[model samples]
Target: MTPLHLTATALASAVGAGSAATLDALRQERSSLAPCDFEEIAIGGQIGRVRGLEQVELPAGFGEYDCRNNRLAWLALQQDGFIEAVRGAIGRHGAGRIAVVLGTSTSGILSAETAYRARDPATGLLPDWFRYDGSYDLFSLSRFVADRLGVTGPAMTVSTACASSARACLDASHLIASGVVDAAVVGGADSLCGLTLRGFDSLDLISPERCRPFDAARRGISIGEAAGFALLEREPLREGGVALLGIGASTDGYHMSSPQPDGIGAEQAMRRALASATLDAADIHHVNLHGTGTRANDLMEARAVNRLFGSDVPCASTKGWTGHCMGSSGIVEALIASLCIENDLLPACHGLETRDPEIALDLERHNRTARIDRVMSNSFGFGGVNVSLVIGRPAR
Candidate 1:
């Protein structure tokens, strides 16, 4: 795989907006999780909801696209002067040469849920004001982002659940490598919606208290919402930025919403990623495990990493800080990887008071400084979809 430089990055989550805010929160070990209070949903699990979405308004002509999800995307684009950096990419590559590929599971279903609730009392028909195509459609995110950036190249939306956005980066890498586009905007945004909440609750995966990944007493996931993006080009627009060294994706036909018990698929993804980067297991400075605080998920990932890197590499999950950001988990953690490379900071596993004795991988015990130049970040989505990315500082 051809390495693509990450020109600029942005993040919006419950902690705050922009990559700087995320960095500050991680440095201070601040977590934004709180008791569930989203939209009158009676679920007891904690959630990481953005601070202010109701007050956020779309630019004039995009009112039809108004929804919590799109609003989150808009907020992310404004972060870290990311929109300006994208405009600069447009200037360099031309709008027609830059593609937009975003990932999300429930793009704007919140809007659809609202519309469904307001159906006519007798007719059972939705109101005329409802714009499913604009808000709820899966393509809304890519289209809105492309329109906002004035980019006219290929636009795609990936919906493979949690692995969505991380896979978006891999797809963008292909587009750039195949000459389909000169540059690509890759990431995802997911907002809190009743459908996601209720569905997960039905599956008995919602943790009542805050999530504690890799902890012996860890229960389950605390649902969260977030938006994160990165711009990828053949080379750095300027100099000295992180780049995607390699990406590997795989599928486990084993189950619909559960990972394979043995984690063979997860190990395969990491091995392939290392091979793709022309590196070895010893080169990975740290790992960002897909530790969702669930028993099955954490155990499977621990086995996979223990098999691949043994106890040499330190690992942790940021879900405890941001909660599980669903479709946005990939890019959120990818950005965290970039931060690790850029700042040499490895975060402690938040809420992890006791380590699981069954897990052999070295989970972070404290916030410490390390020579973190390359990171292997893993994202394992529901239904056995998994992606592993090797991100590091660009070569001199």
Candidate 2:
């Protein structure tokens, strides 16, 4: 399969906006997880809440999409000529020639929750201010983003738990390669909401202390919210950013909520990605692991890494710095991997301390400065959905 080139990528998360701030935090090994102070349902552990969404003014016409999720998407698109890149792709490919594919688990549910809370007692109905019809639909998010960007091509949403955005990347690549579209606006966005917080709380997966991925005493995961966008084209536009070498996806058919104990599915995903990239496991220099800090998840992923890449590849998970941004995790982490290729840096695992005795891998305890040429990012979600994306610097 011909690799689909990624022209540009952008991210907005708790670590900060743009790649510079995110890479800075990664270099410093900073953990941004702090106690959640939101009044609605304050669960302990760090969250990647954007610091100043209140101060950001929306464009005059986009006031209706004012939730934190869309707000962050708007803010991220404003960075480093990202908007221009999308416009350029549109101009080159024509408005109808591009497709839009987004991955999101919680799309506009926060607005629905707000409306549900603001029901008028006198009328027994939602207030007019909160009665917007598209507040709770998942497709609404895709439509909102497509309409906002003037992208008239096929628009679809993928909601396969945490692997959603990663799957979006794979779908976009196929669309562009198959002559379905000339370019694709591929990414995802998710927001914090009371239902998610309480649901995780009910499952007892909310960690009180800061999340410690791969730690010997790792407990559970911390929730987060983010929005990431990447402009992908079939061919390079001038100096292209990085090439999406391959994407591999699988489902374990194991437990609905837990991964296979021996990491069989995860290993298959990584192996498939490497094979699709036409590279050996030894060719990968670094991996952005899906270290959610949960005991089961970390252990399974560690075993998979050991089986596939041995213990030589320096690996780390950025969840400690950005928290687990759920559906957007794949895209956010993919952006980090792209940045690693762009800057020749390997980010440290923010919260890992003592490596688990059961897992054998060269886990980076501190920031490592090296020329990273090839990177793989893993995103595994509930229901055994697993996705692995391999990205590399364009060959000169």
Candidate 3:
């Protein structure tokens, strides 16, 4: 796998609106989770809700894309000078050579949810202003991002549940390696809505308190919303920068929602990623785990990690800080790996208090400093989709 440098990255989640706020939260060991309050969702669990999507306004020409999801994307793009970096890439590669690949699970489905309530009584027709292509469609985010960034190259959205955005990065790497594009804007945005919250509640997977991934007392996930983006280039903007080294994707087809019990799928994904990166397990410094705090998920991932990296790998899950952002989980956590590499910090498994007796792994509990050169992020989603990414400092 040809390494693709992540020249610039940005994030907007419950932790805060940009990478700086996120960094501050990580530095100060803060979590922004609050009681589930959006749209009067009658759920008991806490949620990582971003504060200002209602005030977000799309540019005048892109008003058709006005929805919570796209608004989240707009807010994220304004952060960390990410837009400026994309423009700079366009300047060098030309608009036709840059691609926009984003991920989302319920792309503005809330718009449709709201529209259903306003339907004409007799005909059950939605509001005339509602446009599915610009708002509710799965491709809306990518289209909005590509049009906003003024890029004309290949643009698409990946929607493989939670693995969507990580897979987006992998797909973008393929585009660059195949000479299909010179650069790519890869990330995703997902906004909170009643559908997801209630959906999880129905599955009995919502945690009443803040999620504690890999904790002995862990109960379930805390639903969240976030948007994150990174500029992936053929080469680093400068020397000694974090770059994408390898990617592995697999599906076990074991269950519709639950992960495979033995973790064979997770282990295979991590092994394939290492093979693609041409490195051994010993070369990995840390692992950003996909510990969702659900009983089955955390245990299954633990089994997988132990089988591959052994119990010694310093692993952690940051979901307690931002809740589970669902589709955006891939990009938010993947970018967190880059943040760890850049800052040389290992984030705490935010709410980990006591280790689970059954899931034995070297789960990180407190903030620490270490010489981290390379790391991996695992994103395994529903219906057996799995993806693992390896990120490291660009080779000298």
Candidate 4:
């Protein structure tokens, strides 16, 4: 796979509104989990809830796209001059030459929940203002963003659970390689809602406290909301940018929710990513793990890492700082890995208080300085959808 240059990136999560705040929280070794205050689903467990989405205003004509999910996407797009970068790309490559690919699991389903509650007593009709396609459609996020960004090229949505956005990046790279587009806006956005919260609770995957990814006492996941975006071009818009070197995707079909206990699927994904990148596992400097804080997930991922990279790879999970942003996590964590490459910093595994002796992973306990030239991020989703991405400093 020819590398795709990451020209620009931006994110908004519970840690703060922009990448600068995210970097600060990482530098301070902070965890952003807080008590569950999302809607009326009175459930136990902390969540990575992004603040101020209620205050964000959508574009005047794009009122139908009003929802927590799209608001977060808009907020993220406004950060770090990402919009300007996209505009510049548009100027260089005509609007028809850029593609828009986004991922989301719960795209404004909260709007549907709200409208369902407001149904008329006799007819059971939702509020007149509520349009299912406008807010609740699975493709609404991608459609709204492409319209707002004035991207007229190919546009698509991905909804492969937690691996959604990371897979979107892979899809974008293929589009560029196939000469279908010159550049792509790849990212994802998911917001807090009662549906996802109660659903996880029903699955018994919600933790009562902040999630500890690989701790011996680890229990379950802490749900979070976030939006992240990156602009990927076939060539570097400027020198010294991060590049997506490889992407590996596979499905284990083991269980609907639980990962393959032995991590065969996870192992295959990482190995395939290495093969796609045309590099050995020894070339990877750091890894951003899909450490969801669940016992089964952490164990399986650690086993996979051991089978491949051994104990030498510095590995950590940033979910403690942003929570598990569900589908959006893929893009969020990928951008964080890019930030690490740019700054040469390896963030500590935030929630691991006690190491799990069964796993041989070299968990990062604190921020460390390293001559990191290449990094990897793994996004393994429910229903056995797994993806691994290799990122590196642009080759000189």
Candidate 5:
């Protein structure tokens, strides 16, 4: 795959908005994971819920598309003058030539969940004002963003579990390289709701406390909500920006929720990403593990990295800070890795108090300085969907 420049970026997660806030949290080892208070649910586990989404007011004419998910997206776009940067891209490449691609496992199903509670008692029908297509559908997020951004080019959404947004980046690169579009808006948004919490709880995947990824005492995952956006182009539009050096995606046909116990599929994705970048495992300076604080995920990923990189590459799971943003985990972790390159800092595994002896991961124990030029972030999802992204500073 041709490398594409990440011209501009924005992020809104449990830590805060924009790259500066996120970087500060990482450097200070500050985590945003808190007890689950979302929607007043009695669900257990700490979540990286974004603060103040309820106060965000949508722009005029976008009210109909309003929901927690889209609201979070709007908040993210307002960060670091990201919308202005995107508008400039629109001016350079006509709206019709700029595509939009976003990823999300749960679009705005929260709105539907609310609507269901308000259904007509006699008719057993949802409210007349309820719009399922606008809020609940997977494609709704992309459509809403395209219209809001005034982009007339092809618009689509990716929903391959947790690997969704990272795959969106790959798809966007393909569109640009194929001349289907000159540039693309790529990101993802996932908001917390009752359904997801209950589902995960029923599956016994919800942790009762803050998640400790790669820790010997690790138990389960902590659900979170976040939205991030990146503008991608063939050339850099801004100085000192990051680029998508390589992308690798694979499916091992493994268990529904359990990874290939041996990590073969994860290994392939990382290897292919390095190959696409025209580099080797030795070239990568840092790694962002898909350490969801689950036993199976951490163990499998540890085996995969040990097999490929030999535990030489410094790595950690930022899920302790952001609590696994699920489908949006791809872009969020990518941005975190980009911060690592730009700042030359390796963040500590926030909540990992004790390393799991079984998983031979060279987890970062503290915030430290390093010469980081190339980094890989892994995003492996349920049902064997795996994606590895290689991000690096552009060659001189």
Candidate 6:
């Protein structure tokens, strides 16, 4: 099949609102993670909290359904002419010719948790202030975004843990390539909540200090929240836009919440992505690794990178700057990779001071400029779901 092109992309992560802030943070090796101040959960470490969500007013019709997740997406859509891009796509292709696909793990569950805490003991009904039935459902997020953008074509939500957004990109590319849709808006959004904080704490994966991916003394991961979106089309609508060369996905089905120890599934996913791109492993210039900073996740990804690219491709995990955004991590990192392609620079692993001796891979520990053409982004999720995407510079 002919490859689909990514006409435009935008990101909202802990680093900042758009590509400029993200690139600045990457260049300076600055981390957005800081101690959490929320009292609901006692988990320690840094979190990627968007700064100004509280200031934005929701649309008139969606007053009662507002939540942090939706609010963040709304704020992000306003950046980098992203909303205008989506509107243009719809106008050119017709609203029915565009599709909306979003990936999220928590959705708006945070709003539900808030409402649950305010339940009335007498009537067992939540207060009107906390009433948000539509905000609590996972499907509502996609619906909200679709309705706001007036996209009338296929709309769906993907929830595959960490690989959610990466798989969303895969699905969007497939739909455009198959002519099911002339264009697609693909990305993910997730907001911080007590449920996730405690959930990770219960598993002993919360770090007290900033996360240090690939560091020899790394402890665990720092949870984060983010929203990212991209526009994909069958052909380039503008010159010099990056092309989505190929995407590969696989599931090991090994464990419920842990990855395969041998990294076999991850290696397979990378191999498949290379195959789909019709390029050998040597063709990959950089890798945006799924380095969560947890002991197991980083080790497994290191092994997978070593096996797939033989330590030649420069790889770095941007989680140190953005924290682990969970479901939205894939799209955030994928956008970072896209920026690398556009600017011909490689982002540094912000918190990585020393490399683990056990891992035999070239980890980028400092900001470095390079002429990057082809790059790969890896997203491995719980249940051994793995996704790899290969993106290249626009074809000349």
**All candidates: TM-score:** 0.98, 0.95, 0.99, 0.98, 0.98, 0.96
Worst 10 residues of 3 by lDDT: 359-368
Q: Identify the runs in model 3 with alpha carbons over 4 angstroms from their true place.
A: none
lDDT of 5 by residue, 100-208 (tens): 9999988999999999999999999999878888877888899988998889999999998888899898888889888999999998988888877888888888889
Scored against the true structure, residue 288 in model 2 reaches a CA lDDT of: 93
lDDT string for model 6 (1-396, tens) is 356677767778878888898888877778889888654466777787777776866677876558888887777776678878888888889999998999998888888787888889999997777645557777777888888888998998999998999999888877877788988899989888888888888888888898999899899898888899888877687777787788888998799778887788999999989888888888899999999988898898888888878877898898998989988988888888888888888888878888988887787678888999888999998878999988887456
- Cα-based lDDT for every prediction: 0.90, 0.83, 0.90, 0.91, 0.89, 0.84
lDDT of 1 at 344: 83
Better of 2 and 4 by TM-score: 4
TM-score of 2: 0.95
The digit string of per-residue lDDT tens for model 1 on 59-121 reads 889887888999999999889888899999999989999999999999999988999989999
Tell me the tens digit of each residue's lDDT in model 2 across 1-105.
476777877788888888888888877777667788654475666676778865776567866666666776777777667777888888898989889899988
lDDT of 4 by residue, 359-391 (tens): 788886789977788888999888899999999
Alpha-carbon shift of residue 184 in model 2 (angstroms): 0.5
Q: Where does model 4 exceed 4 Å of error?
A: none
Model 4 has an lDDT value of 0.91
Count of backbone collisions in candidate 1: 0
Model 3 / residue 182 / CA error / Å: 1.0
TM-score of 6: 0.96
